[model samples]
Target chain A: MSRPRLTFLESSLPYAVNAARLIVMDRGMFVADFFLATTVPFLMQFLIWSYLYQGSSISRSFGVLSLSQTLFYYAFSIAFGRLNNGYDVVSNLSLNVREGTLEPHLLRPVPYPLQKLADFMGGGVVYSVPIILVLAVFVFIPPVALNSFFWPGWVLLVVVSQILCFTLSWTVAMMSLWLVRTDFALSLLTTSAAFFGGELLPPYLWPEWLRPLMSYNPFRFMISAPAQAIVTMDGGFVMTALAWTSFYAIAFGCLSAFLWRQGMKRYRGAGG
Target chain B: MKKYLLFFRLGLAVELAYPVDFIGYVFTTLFVHLTRFLFLNGVFDLTSTLEGWTRRDVMVAFIFSVLLSSVVDSFTPSIRTFVRYAHTGRLEPYLVQPLDARWVMIARWIRPGSLFIFAIIAPIAMLTLSNLNVHPTLLQAVGGLFALVIGAIVNIAVMATWSLTTLVSKRDLPTEFIFRQVMRLNQLPPSLFGYKALTALVIFLPIVLTSTVPAMVVARGEYFLLAPMLGAAVLVMILFMISFRMTMRVFDGSGG
Candidate 1:
């Protein structure tokens, strides 16, 4: 009798399940992460914006968004920010490279990047539940309402942006193969994303000179585009964002492949 | 004190050996702070004032926040090492040292790269203050500096207490993540949260003492704020000491 052969999906499913299981097991850390990463930041933004928009002739609306809409933007962005986060990918890859753990992964039949992607998706599954719950509160709770038609576009952008975020993170992580340490690189990447991705401030509020950079950055696709899709309810914007995100995702995917190939040439493993 | 100085010197020497890493650290710190400043600029453009906090006042608060963060970042490695030692039962060496065990645990290691944050940000801070026309009196200057020092102590005590949780929980919960997020609250004036939240933060968490009070003391010549800041610092320090003793008593070292 011949042994059964597993397809790509079959092989990858376990990695995702294992990653999700680990996240579920670490309930304490996950809760803390959700609260600190999403809830607290949103609260801070709420207080700041509420105080700023309090008594003014500006009529509650700043640029394209009213105060409540702006709050919803932040609530969605912060939650989706955590949902699409790639820090674990960077940390895990760097640790593997440093410890020469890549040797085993290379020997495995499956591609290393696919394995990592599977793991990333698995962890994201665990995070997406709470993120959806949080967004539900923002959408269903009074004082903030969203058009039902925008939900499909919002979901499409989020799905595409996750791929873009993962690819960008993977590309950045490949640099650890050549660098002595990646702590600085990690910090730079995180700050740049937060600043340029409209996490800290909306694109409408950005200075005119910074408009080009703010519009074209990969992080904008990952963070601001999806948030805007729901709040702005513009089909054209969502389609444009989806197209750009797909372009960046493919570009980064190719770049990551090229870097990994070149890095493997320099890979001497533990003994070298 | 001499031993601590020696440890600091050794850490500095090690940091100096990696000049490239130090430069990268400085650049990254600058980028982070500059972006934060720009974000504040965007906010100020929308409104002239936020809850009576002018752009200049917020800038002052931001500088103080940076100082507090720098101090905590410098000591972060020591806190991590203490947590690791607690888990691995490797704390015996520090315990056997002639120095106080608690001090040894918290001050044995340092990341000297973090000290460069001061050099990088101080000039920028000074320029921003000058642009705001914030010149403190001599006495106000002294009080501001005192408040900053106490603020750092309170921040460190809070982190130390958080790290001590590893002994009781037996899990290396990502205390650094929580610490960093909590520290984010200091980036703005606590008063923006209103009086009730400010009182709660001061009494329970005391994070307001880390930056807001010091900024007010320096920028607005509010010397009366120092008394509450000092009191909070002393109270937090006592709490840290108590937690440290109790946690250490229960620590049956998990084998390294």
Candidate 2:
């Protein structure tokens, strides 16, 4: 059809890229912009932590760790935000089905999943600029302690966690097919992961009782496990987390793929 | 209101269509809430009371802030209302509309999916409040709901006040971006802020009234009845009036 036809499958991918780029370049979400607004509060936080804890880094571990963790967070979050393989794509594609546009995607030249990923990464590092800046400020400062764990372990954890998060999220996104609603599924992941995965705050900060539960949860492996390994230099359970992460990523990825194929077989052309 | 209903229905369809996004949004909200919890946890460990509230009280206040604010911000018009519309030059269309544009703008946000934000945490907040053993009478419930209404008013006013800067600023984007960060203040416990900051928040900004007062009413026991609660609503209304005047001037390109 000579392509770029404004067809459902073709149109959404470009739109996604444009949208991501728009959000990033969006003057409101700028790097300098975030820094300007955040400086006072961050400084306030920094001052509060630095003064109270003074030489005792242990007191404000999250704040102290952020000195290094923040940088990694900024870099990883920005790059990884694009690499997110699920979330919006799942939501959008799911919408395409409900809206009766799924059939067009099935007709496309590109593999739909790959197309979604391409669209996501199109804007590249733009959306992450703010995070990047936040990280950069922390770059000059040393991480609280990095002597204990090897960099490779930290790297492996980061890579694995990202994989795990992406894999699980991708699987979770497929729920849109059979279900009338997917919000519950999404909420469940986000809430658990936010704490357990270490996105909202570090898992270490969670109460001791909560920590054990979080340690076993895949959520921690995705964000905090690697992050803590890098910043705290603790690798005691890094391998364990990585193993679980790998298991979930592969398991969930296969499950999602199977479900999608099966669902596609039952797919009636829209308005069903 | 009818216009709002129509827009709300439209929004519902759009939201329902992308149910998967509900999860992503939930995740982001979860992340933000966790961030606050950790902050409070650390601060509490460091020192007992930031101002007058205990560590438990502060935690309750934070959860209240996030839960209620999530409802107000998401369901109400403009998810990040001020910046999204103000920057897109989208606010202009609203001004020309015949109905109460501000009301329309505020009420335009209807994310039924956002309902999950409240549902997931409501039990938790209540459970925590129960654990704290602070009980409010039926009158307190009315008063707390009243505080939420005030919170809605204050949120709208704050958005509008930021809208005033949206009018004249050389860089509208920067203004919105700045306001976005300013929006973060709502997520925090007001008592942690100093008097000037707290007063500014309670009076000029009105952020304190959103979460703190209601939480106080519920968790603060008998004092909820007597503390200067009406002042926050009155203050926000006044700010709205002032910002509305500025908006008019800005609309004419005089101030903006």
Residue-wise C-alpha lDDT for candidate 2, range A1-272, written one tens digit per residue: 58454665565567457756665655553554445454433434443444444455345455445453554543343233323324555556656766677777667766676565556545433544543454455444653433445657655665565556656776776766776355456545544554455543445555667677766676666655654554445666667767887887788778878877987777675543
Candidate 2 local Cα displacement, residue A9, angstroms: 19
Model 1 chain A — which ten-residue stretch has the worst lDDT? A142-151
Candidate 2 lDDT over B1-256, as tens digits, reads: 6777786787778776765565666776777677667757765765555545777777766866777767764643353353355545666666677877556545565565566678888888778777877667888777776776676666656655554555555234444334444555554545556657666655555653567777677666534422454676676667767776665665543222
Off by over 4 Å in 2: A1-24, A30-87, A122-124, A127-139, A143-160, A180-186, A234-244, A269-272, B1-52, B59-63, B66-74, B77-103, B108-145, B156-187, B199-205, B216-256
Worst lDDT 10-window in candidate 2 chain A: A76-85
Error of 2 at A255 (Å): 2.1
Clashes of 2: 7
Q: Pick the candidate with the highest lDDT.
A: 1
Best by DockQ: 1
Q: Local distance difference test, per candidate?
A: 0.79, 0.58
Pairs clashing within candidate 2:
A186-B23, A190-B27, A197-A219, B77-B106, B77-B109, B167-B256, B168-B256
Predicted structure with the largest TM-score when compared to the true one: 1
Per-residue alpha-carbon lDDT of candidate 1 for residues B126-154, written as tens digits (9 for 90 to 100): 78777889998888778878988998898
